[model samples]
Target: MKTQDQAAQGKVALVGAGPGDPELLTLKAVKAIFRADVLLVDDLVNPDILDHARFGARIIHVGKRGGCQSTPQEFIERLMIAEARAGHFVVRLKGGDPFIFGRGGEERAHLLDAGIEVDIINGISSGLAAPSSIGIPLTHRDWSQGAVFVTGHGKTADANPDWDALAKLGMTLVIYMGVARCREIQQALLAGGKPASTPVAVVHAATSGSQAQLITTLGDLPAALTESRLASPSIIVIGDVVRCASQDLFHRLTAEPDRIAG
Candidate 1:
C-alpha cells in the first residue's frame, strides 16, 4: 500500500480527530496529519487537534454548524477530488468518527467512484465520549446489555416514531448532536413503552477538559436541559446504567456546576 508520504495523486485519508481534546488522537491519526499536505477539517474539529499537522499544511475549514454559512456538500466533494487529484496527501479530518454522522460516507462514495484510493481511520465518537465524560455507562449487565445510537435531528422530528422493538432491546439509548429535539425523542421513547423514569444524562463537550453533565429522568428531558442550561452539540444518554456514573471512569472528567461551553 502506498504510504501517505508517497503522495499519490488519487489518495485520501479520512481521519477522525476524535471528540475535542488533542490528546485523544490516536498515533496513526497523528501520523496521517503530519504527512498530509492539505487538511479538510470540519467546523467542530478542535483547533488543538490541528497542532499535530506538519508545518505549512494547507488547512481548509469546512463550515458545518446548524445555522452557519456552510459549504455545500457537492462543493466539498469537489474540493476533495481537486486536492487528491493534485497529488497532495489530503487528510479529511472530522470531529467525531468519520462514519458516524459526518458526511464521510458521501465523500468516500464520490471519491471511490472517481477511483481515488481512500483510507478511513476510526476515532472515538462524542456519542461514546459524552456518556463516559459524565460517568454514564451506556450498558450494564443488570441495567442494559446493549446500546443504540440515534440522531435527534433526523426524520420523525414532529411525528411519533414507531420504534421497532427498541423498547424491549434492553439497550441503553444514546442520542448524538441532539439537544434541541431531545424532548421529542424522549417522548417518543416513552410512548414506545420505555419507562418514563428512565435515567438520562446530558453530557456537554464530553471528553474535553471542559465537560458538564446533567442528570435527569427521561420524562424531564426538556425541563432538565432548560433548567440546567445545556444546549445543542451535547450528547444525550438515556438508561439506568447512568446511576453508576459518579463512581465510574468519567468521574474525573466531570465538570462543575458552571461550565464554559464554547
Candidate 2:
C-alpha cells in the first residue's frame, strides 16, 4: 500500500506493450498503465492497450515510425524528465521488448542521469512472435543450430550490419525494420556467400488483424517484397528453419478436417 506522497513522487516506468495483440500485454505492464499519471506511447503500440490506463490518465502519443514524421528522441526525453519532476508517474509505453531496438536504453540512461527513478517491464518482441505466429521456428535441432536478431535499419549507413559474418553463422536471421532496404540487404547476403535458394519470409503487422506474410527465396526477396507491396513494421526471417513451416509434419498438423477425411 503506497501512500499518496509516495504515489506522487516523480518516477518513470519503461513498459513494453508486446508485439501488437492487446491480450499479449503482461500483467505488470497493465498495472503500470493503471498507475501512470501520464503515458508516452510509441507509434506501433495498439490503441487497445491504452484501455488499461486509469480514467483521467494523460496519454501522449510520441511514436517514432520510420520514414514518417516522428517525435524527436531528445524532446521525448526532456518531456519525460519534466513530467516526472513535476511529481507525476510517467509511463513510457513502447511496442515490443523495450530493450530490443526500442531505444529504451537511451531513454533509461537519460532519465537516470536526470535523477529520476526508472523501472523496466519487459514484453514480447516481434522478432520471436512474428516467426512463431507463422509456424517458423527460430531454432530447430534438424535445421538451425541457433538464431540471430538484427535491425535492418541502423543509426547510419556505416553502421549497417556485417552480413558476411551473419552468413557464416549458418543460423536463423530475424531482421527488424528491413523492408525499406531489402534490396541492399539481399545483395549483401548474396555477396557474403549465402545461397540464393535460402528461404526468406516477411511478416507484416504481426499478431494483428491485418497481419500478412510473404515467403520467397533469398535471391527473390526484393522482387517478392516489391510485388507484394508490403510496408514497414515487418520482420524478415531467413534460414533453413523457415522451411519448417512447409514440412510435411506441419502440413499434416494444419490440414483441414475435411481434407484429412477425404
Candidate 3:
C-alpha cells in the first residue's frame, strides 16, 4: 500500500491542439485538457481550444514563438516536472501534431528521465491539413509517387536538410516553417534540377477562419511571396499535385480576394 504522497505523484500528458481549428482537436486531447490541473500551452495553439479545460484549471502560457521572446525548452521541461511532482496533472499543449516538429519528444524524454509518466494524444498536423484546406493533395498516383515533410529551420545551420537530395526524391515536398527562407529554398530547388515551372502553393493559418492561400510556380515563388507578404506559421507545398487542385475548388477557396491569391 502506497502513502498519500506516493499515490499523488502525477503524470504528464502531451496533447496536440491540431492546426488552428478547435474542432480538429482529438477527443483524447479534449479529455486531457479537461482533466489537467495545469496546462503549458504553445503560441500557435488556437485560444478557443483552451475553453475545453475545466473551470479553475491553471493555464500557463509557455509558448515559444519564433523570432520572439520565447520560453526556453529546458525551463518548460523543468516546469512540467515540478508541476507533476507537486501532484498536478500537467498537460503540455502544442499546436499541430505533437510529434510533428512540436518538440514533444524532447519533453517526453526529460519527464521519463525524471521518472514521470507521459501520455501522447495525436492531433492533425498543419503539414497535412494546410494543403488539404487549399485543395492540394499531398500525394496522388498520377502526380506523385510519395511525399516528404521537412522543416524550414533547423537547430543548427549544418543540420539543415540537403535541398539537392530532397529535390531528387521525385516526390511532393511539404515544408513547414519555411516562409522566412522561401527565397533560399526556391534557389536551392532550382539549382538542384527541379524544373522552374513546378507548381507551388503557400497556405497560411490553415483550418482557421483567418486561413489564406497563395498559388504560384516554383519560378515565381520567391517574387510571389515577397509581393504577397505571407509570413510565418505557414506551410509551403511543392509538386505536380498542386496543379491537380480542382479549378472550381480553387475559385471557391480564393473567392475572398483578401484571403487568397494566385
Candidate 4:
C-alpha cells in the first residue's frame, strides 16, 4: 500500500535512564520512552522505568554487565539500523549518563555510518549520585578543589586507567567498576604516593532502596570490601571529601587505625 519514499523515516534516541531511580529520569528521556516503537535496554536500566513506554511498544533487553554474558555490540547496532530503516522509532536506553561510559559514542558512530538519524538525552550519572546520596560533597573548598571520574576496569588490559597518574591529581577520585580489582587499585594508588590514610567510601546500588555503603582509609579498602561483601554496580569515592559524609551513616568498624564506617 505504501512505497519506500512514503514510509515513515524513523530515528534513534540514545536515552540515559539515570542511576536506578525511576524518578531521576529527565523529562526528555520520559518523552522518548513514550514515543519509541522499539527500545533496546541495558541491564543497569531500572525495569520500573518502562512504565513510561507506550502500549504495544517492543522492548528488547540487551544486558551488558562486566564479567557477565552480554548481547554483542555489533548485533545491537545492526538491530538499531534495521529497526530505523523499517520505519520504527528506536530508543537505546542505557543507565547513567549515556556519554559517561555508557558506550553511547560507539553507538552514535555506528548509526552515523549507516546514515540513521540519532538524538541523545542526558541523565544523572551514578558518580554524582553515589557521593550525594551519603551527603558527601565531591568538591569542597578545604577538601578537594575538583573531582575525577575513572573506570576501575577497562575493556582490555592496556585500556585500563593509569592509576599512577590519577593518584597524584589532588582531586576527589570516583571509581566505577573497581570493586573486583579493589586490591590492585589500592596498591597502585599507594605506590603512586597516595597516602595509605586517604579516606575512601564505597557505595553499592547508590540512590536505590537496597543501597549500602562503607567508609575506610585507602590502606583498609580491600579488607573493608571483603568484610562488607559489596560487589559490582558500586561506586568508590576516594579523597578527603569523604570525611564530609553524614554522621548518621558512619559506623566505626574498628578504632585501632583509620575508622571503618559500615
Structural RMSD, model 4: 2.5
Per-residue alpha-carbon lDDT of candidate 3 for residues 169-236, written as tens digits (9 for 90 to 100) = 88999999898888899899999999987888898899988887788778888777878787878999
Q: Give the range where candidate 2 is weakest over 10 consecutive residues by summed lDDT.
A: 253-262
How many steric clashes between backbone atoms does each model show?
A: 1, 1, 0, 0
Give per-residue lDDT, candidate 4, residue 40: 98
Arranged by TM-score with the best first, the candidates are 4, 3, 2, 1
lDDT of each: 0.78, 0.88, 0.88, 0.91
Off by over 4 Å in 3: 1-5, 246-262
Candidate 1 residues 118-195, lDDT tens each?
A: 999988899988777655777788888888887666635453334545655768878776787676676667778888
When 1 and 4 are scored with lDDT, the better candidate is 4
The top-ranked prediction according to TM-score is: 4
Top-lDDT structure, candidate number: 4
lDDT per residue as tens, model 2, 179-257: 9999999999999999987878788888998887777778878877887788989999999887766454234423521
Deviation of model 3 at 178, angstroms: 0.5
Candidate order (lDDT): 4, 2, 3, 1
Question: In terms of TM-score, which candidate is stronger, 1 or 3?
Answer: 3
- Lowest-sum lDDT 10-residue window in model 3: 251-260
- Superposed Cα deviation of residue 173, candidate 3 (Å): 0.5
* Residue 142, candidate 1: alpha-carbon lDDT: 86
Model 1 Cα displacement at 47 (Å)?
0.5
